[model samples]
Every structure is written in C-alpha cells, then in structure tokens.
Target: MNLFDLGWDDFASKSFHPFCSGDLVPARVALGHKHACELLSAHGELLAECTGRLLHETASHADLPAVGDWVAVRLRPDEPRAGPASRRRADIHAVLPRKTKFSRRAAGDDGGEQLLAANVDTVFLVTALDANYNLRRIERYLAVAWESGAQPVVVLNKSDLHPDPAAIRAAVESVAIGAPVVALSAAHDESVAALAPWLRPASTIALLGSSGVGKSTLVNRLLGEPRQPTGAVSDAVGKGRHTTTRRELLVTPSGALVIDTPGLRELQFWDVANDSLDSTFADIAALAARCRFGDCAHRSEPGCAVQAALEDGSLDADRWQSYQKLQREQAYAARKADPRLAREHGTAWRKIHRAQRMQQRLKSGE
Candidate 1:
C-alpha cells in the first residue's frame, strides 16, 4: 500500500525526517493488539512491536500505537520469521505527534485519559434515530469532539427507523451546534455518499458512538465490502449487538481512510478545550458575556442574560442544563487530574460564595 494512501503527508514527513536517514521507515497503524499492531507502510502491510527503548520510555498506554497513529518503524525485510504465513515484522521506534485525538476519561476512576482515535481529520459522531438516540448524549459527545481539534460531523444513522427523520435531524441540529448534521441510513451505498465531501484523499475520519449506532455498517458501505462485522439490534434490549470487537483502519479505493471502533460504554470528558464551551454553546456563552456581573453564575445574579433567556422562550431549558453538566464534569476531571488545581478551585469557589454572601448582607443593611 502507498504511504500517501495511509494518510501520510508533508507534515508527517517532516516529523519523521530524523528517522528517515536511519533504517527506520514511516508507517500508519492499521490494527492494534495487546503487544503488537498491524502497520501499513511503503513496504506494504507488516505486523510490528514496540522496541524495548520505546516501551521503556513510554509513560502511558495512550502513548502506544493506536489506530490511525503514524509511527517510525525499523523493518526486518528478507529475514525469516517463525510464522505460518512467513509474514514480515518490524519494530516501532517512535510515534509521530498527533494533530488531533479523540479521548475520554478511562472507564474507571484512574484520573487518566484513554485515547479512542488519533490524528483524525474528521470525527463522525454517529447516533441512531432509534430509541438509542438521546439529545443529551449527543451533547456529551460534542464536548469531546470539540476538544479533539477535528471537524465534527453528526451522522444520524438509521433514519429509516424514525417516524420523521427530518424533524429528528432538526432536533439534533439544535444541539450539534457548529457541527454539520447529516442524516442517512448507512445500509445503502448512495445514501452514505452524503459524507463524500469529507472523504477527501489522504484524510482520516473516525466513526464514534454508542453500540448499535451502525459505525461498522458505515465503514462497510464506504469500503464497498463487508470487512467489518455487523450485528443486528437486539429487539429485547433495544441496542445493537456487539459486532465490531476491535478498532481497525481501512483505506477506500478513493484514498480516504476510515477507522471503526467498538461502541464506547462511557463517554467522559478528557481535556476540555479553552474554546469548546464557547464553540459548542455559543448561544449560552453569548448570553453569559452580556451579563452585568463579570462572574455571573446565571443562577441568581441580577441582569443575568442567561436567566433572562430561560425566562423567555429564547433558550432551551434542557440545553442549559446539559451545558452546566458538561462544564461541571470538565471542571471535576481537571481537578482530579491535578491536586494543586483542585485545591485552587476549592479556594476560588469559597471566595466567590463569600463575596455573594457579603453582597446579600450589604443589601439587607446588616
């Protein structure tokens, strides 16, 4: 396979320049296993393992080769391997810097991030029009998508199952905000073509959503084959059965790259971007900016535009709640990840509350 077809470009070339002079070659991770990963490079497909130095220097599992990651590997071509198929092997020496990464807090309370996909150009936040669809869940996914530094496209799959997909699409549009909303049944080839605009040559797109959201079906549609397994939705559970067991990247005949990952059970905030709130909830941010108090909590602050919007019909009550929930989650995650910052936040909140109490006492002529 061509390196360009694996999403390699000038930026990647520059990143691997130091390793270029050595026996090392650049490769893109196709499928990652426990201790090894399938890589695509100028030498074609090969299975590779991280070298001792690479492993010893790695601080976190997220630093390891993940699907859609580019790495510098040293190939042992012409060397005999003790394998049934005599497949070639390589040693991954280094990983290239990721331009964008989709991450979430680990499943447990480790206070660490788990990388879902890396170096992606676009992220398709897939959601079903079935019972699995939830506006708040879409809002949650949008938080991480905005922080990933990639363009988010809300793909409302399984439109055929909905009573009125157009109405549902409008509802999703309200929460998706800056992201483009595209509703289509991935079961059809022509219907999935609506995503063609983002499937440019040498660009990587990741499919992410809860189970049964048709991410594998979307990949198969784009691949023009049934490479990724698909499972029917269990009527009893109202969720799609587990079909994709692992994450894998495949290049289309048109040179576009697509990655399909298993359904995420828990989507938590990782690194809250400085502008994600402003970008995802522009309406609320704008209203807050117009508040009379610079630190308006939007709760009981006088001249608070947010509360005023909620008083009128301008703002959706549920959306404001979702924004607050996400903000709290991000703030908590930040504090948990850093103890010093946690103490500082505690102090800050105390000061704010004290100030509010003092103002109330003065108003009461205490």
Candidate 2:
C-alpha cells in the first residue's frame, strides 16, 4: 500500500527519516487492542506489539499507539509462521507526531487524557435522529472536534425515522456554528453519498458518537459490505447495543480511510482550550465581546449581552446553558490538570467556606 493513500505526507516522511535508516519500517495503526495492534505497512497488513523499550520509555497510555497513528515498526519477517493463526508480525518502536488527534478524558478518576483517533482530517460526530437526538451532546462533540484540530461535520443518521430530516439538520446547524450538518439514513446506500464531500480519497475521517448511533452501519454502507456488525436499538430505551468494542481503521473502496470508534459511554473534557471552546460556541463568544464588563460572567451580570439575548429569546436557552456547562467543565478539567489552578481553586473555596462560617457565628451571637 502506498504511504500517501494512508494519509502520509512530506512532513511524515521527514519525521520518519531518522528511523528509516535503521531496521524500522513506517506503518499506520489500524486496530488497537489491549496488548497488540494491527498495522498497515508498505509490506501489507501485519499484527504488531510495542517494544519493551517503547513501553518503558513512554510517559503514559496516551503515548501508546492508537488507530490512525503513524509509527515505526520492526518487522519479524525471518521468523517462521504457521498459518493464519501465526501471521506476519512486528514490534512498534516509535510513534510519529500526529498532525491531528481526537481525544477525551480517560474514564475513571485517574484524570488522564485518552487518545481516541490520531492524524484524522475530519471527524464525523454521528447522532441518531430517533429518541437519541441531542443538541447538547452535539455541542460537546463539536468542542472536542475543534480541539482535535480537525474539521467537524455533524452527521444525523436515521433520517428515515425522523418525520422531517431537514428540520433536524436545521436544529443541529444552530448549535454546530459554522460546521456542516449532514442528515442521511445510513441504512440506505444512496443516502450515505451525502457524506462524500468529507470522505475524500487519501484523507482520514473518524466516526464518533454514543453507542447505537449507526457509526458501524455508516461504515458498512461506505464499505458496501457488512464488515462491521450492526445491532438493533432496544424498543424499551431506544438505545442501540454496543457492537464496536474497539477502534479500527478501514479503507473504503474509494481509497478514503475511516476509523470507527466504540460508542463512547462517557466523553469528558481533556485539554480543551479557551480558543477551541470559543470556536465551538462562536455565537456565545461573539455576544460576550459586546458585554459591558470585560470579564463578564454572563450569569446575572448587568449589561451582559448573553443574558440580554437569553431574556429576549434571541439565543437558544439550551445552547447558552450548554455553553456555560461546558465552560465550567473545561475549567474544572484544566484546574485538575494544573497544580497552580487547583491550588487557587482550593484557596477560593476555603475563603468562601470561612465567610459562610463567619455569617453563621454572627447569627448565633458568637
């Protein structure tokens, strides 16, 4: 396979040059498992594991290989293999710097970043139009997409189930800001063509959303085969069963690369900056510029444009609230990631607690 078809460029070539003189070969990670990975190299598809040195030298799990990541691997061609059970394999030594990455806070209380997909050019934020339609969720996805340094296109799947797909697209457009919103039923082959603009050859796109949002179905449609499993939504909760358990990168017949991620049960903020948040909530940011106070909180602050818009029904109440909620969550995540911010937050809370205690003492005539 040509490296260009895998989204490789001169930049990647230069980055891999230092390793090329050695026994290492360039490859792109296709499927990432618990301890092993499937890579697509110039020699063809092969299974690979991280070298002990690589693992020991890595800072965290985020440094490990992820689907769509380009890496240097040492092929074990001389090793005798039996059949399909023992195919060609290699050891990943190094991961090239990613041009773009989609990530979220790792699940659990560890407060670590989790890399979802790397070197992606576009992110398809999929959402089912059934009972699972949610604008707030879309906003959250958009914020992360912007943070990933990739163009985000909102894909509203299951359009056939919705009475008015256009109306649904319009609703998504309101929160999507400048991002394109595509409404199509992935169940039909023709409808999937709507995504062709973003599915260009030699570029990579990732399917991300809550489980049962038809991400796998969309991949199957694009592949023109049932390569990915599809499951029915439960009649009780309208949620689809989790079929994709891991992230896998697949090549479409048109030569475009697509990564399908397991349905995200929880997507928390990690490393989301103010610029990305402003980009996602451009409407709110624009309004904030006109506020009388430079540091306007936009809550009950007087002459706050955001508050004025909300009162006059100019801004969607839900969108504004979603922005505020995301802002707080992002701030909290930042504080957790930075010790100074955490210390300042702790000190402020301590002051507030002390003030409350003083008020209580005064009431008690102490």
Candidate 3:
C-alpha cells in the first residue's frame, strides 16, 4: 500500500524541510487509542506507541499525536536500544502544520478548547432528515464549521426514512447561505455519489452530528463495507444510540481519507475568527452597516437598522435573534481567555448602564 496516496505530500512538503534530513521515516497517524497509535509509515502499518522521552517531555494534550497529525518517527524494527528495551516505539519528532483544525471547547468548567481533528479539508455536517431534523441546530453547526478553516457541506442523511426529505433540505438551505446541502440515505446508498467531489483521493473529510444520525452507516457506505458498526434508532425517540465511541480515520475504497467521530451532544464555541460571525450572520451584519450610528447595539438603540428590518418584516425576527445570540456567544468566547480584561470590560458596561438608568430617572424626576 502506497502511503503517499493517503495525502503524504502535504506532510512531506511542510514538515520534512526543517527537521530530519536523512533516513527519517514520515508517517500519518491513522488511529489514536489512549497512548497507542496505528501509524501508516513508509515501512508499513505498525502498532506504534510514543517514545518514553516524547511522553516524558510532553506536558499538554496538543503535544500528543492526534488522528490526523503527520509525524516523523524513528523506526527500529529488528534492533533493541539500550533504554528499557526499545519495543518498536515511534518517537513523534515533529508535527506538521495543519491546514484546517476543527475544535470545540471541552465540556465542563475547563476553559480550554480541544482540537477534534486537524488538517481536515472539508466537514460533513450530517443531520437526519427524519424527526431529528433541526435547522437551528444545523445553523449552529455551520457557525462552528465556519470557525474551522474547512468548508462545510451539509449532509441530510436518512432521507430514505423520511417521506419528504426535500422539505428538510429546503429548510436547511434557506439558512445555508450558499453552502452546499445534499440529501441522501446512507442505508440505501442512494445519492451518495453527490459527495464525490469532496471525497477525492488524499482529501480528508469528517462527519459531525448528533447520535443516531447515520454517521456510522454513512461511513460504512463510503468505505464500501461495514467497517463501522451500525445501530438501530430507538423506537420511541427515533434516535439511534451512540455507536461510534471514538474518532478514527478510515480510508475509503476511492482512496479518500475520512475521520468519523463519536456523536456530539453539545456544540460549544471556540477560537472563532472575527469574520466567522459576519459570515454566519451575513444578513444581520450587512444591515448593520447601514445603521445610523457606527456602533448600533441593535437592542433598543435609535436608528438601529437591524431592529428596523426585524420590525418591518425585512428580516426574520427569530433568525435575527439567533444571529445576535451567536454573536454574543462568540464575543464572550473571545474575551474568555482574559478574565481580568473581561471583568474590566464588564465594569465599564455596568457603569454605562448605570449612567443610562440615572439619566432616565432624572428625566422622569423619580
């Protein structure tokens, strides 16, 4: 098996220059389970583990090898080194720069974001066309996808189960803002060809959605076999139970590489670019440009173009509110790292609010 067909050129061109010059083996991590990894190297597929030195020196989660990280490994097949009897461990000397990384803030009180998948060229935001269909959730996923550097292609899976998949697609497309949306049934294998453009050889795509959305079934379809197990959806809730428990990269028969991750119940905000909010809420952002004041909050502010549009039926009120909520969340996430600065900004806002309240009280003589 030629590892070069698995997008090795990307790693070779970017990582090979500065680090190892002679007899260094470059490999891509196919799967990561705890401390063990399955690496596709120039030699062959090997059950690999990180070196003790690498593990001892690593302090952060990002330092570990992820599913898509390209690493330079020192191969020792038939020889044992002096330290602790070297047992074919791969020393991940360096990580290649990622083209695009999909990440999310980890659940709970920890403020740090976790990198889910790196170097993904495209993101398949899968959603079931059945009762699980939710345009609002799709919209949120779109924001997260835009925040990542990858292009998002919305996939409305389980179309065969729905009587009218067109309705769901239309509703999702209404807010897709020109993003490509495809309706297909992963079980029946129909219209799966529509995703071929993104499944080109060496291209890496990831499927992200809630449980029972047929992501695993879709993975089986793409692989042309039942590589990932499938589970039946609950009869009561019509939702499939969580089947895929880990993020593993699989190579399809078409030679395209794909990473299938476990279902995500909560999609949180992370390090979003400044333009991501504008791109996700283009309608609101564009109208804000025409506002009378340069900094219209769109809240009860006079001459608020966004509020005017919402009131006059030019823009959907619900959609506008959703846009505002996401914008506020993005703003909060941006300031989350600097707690001190956030507190200072909060104090300034509170002072402004108090001043406004005092002015209103004086005007009414209350």
The numbered model that scores best in TM-score is 2
Poorest stretch of ten by lDDT in candidate 2: 234-243
Instruction: Tell me the lDDT of model 3 at 175.
Output: 85
User: By the lDDT metric, which is better: model 2 or model 3?
Assistant: 2
- Please write out the lDDT profile of model 2 over residues 206-260, one tens digit for every residue: 9999988899899989888888766653222224234233337999998899998
229-336 per-residue lDDT for model 1 (tens digits) = 776532222353432234388887777899987777779887786488668888888889999999998999899999999999699999999898889888888787
- On lDDT, the candidate that comes out on top is 2
Over 4 Å off in model 1, which ranges?
Answer: 81-86, 232-247, 343-366
- The positional error of residue 80 in candidate 2, measured at the CA in angstroms, is 1.5
Candidate 1, residue 28: Cα displacement in angstroms equals 0.5
For every candidate in turn, the CA RMSD to the true structure comes to: 4.9, 3.4, 5.3
lDDT of each: 0.85, 0.87, 0.77
Badly placed stretches (over 4 Å) of model 2 are: 84-86, 232-247, 347-366
Q: On residues 105-223, what C-alpha lDDT tens digit does candidate 3 reach at each position?
A: 77887656676777777999999988778877887888988888789999999888888888878877878884799999888876799899899898888888887898888998999
What TM-scores do the predictions have? 0.88, 0.91, 0.83
Model 3 segments more than 4 A misplaced: 10-12, 56-59, 79-89, 232-247, 337-366
Ranking by TM-score: 2, 1, 3
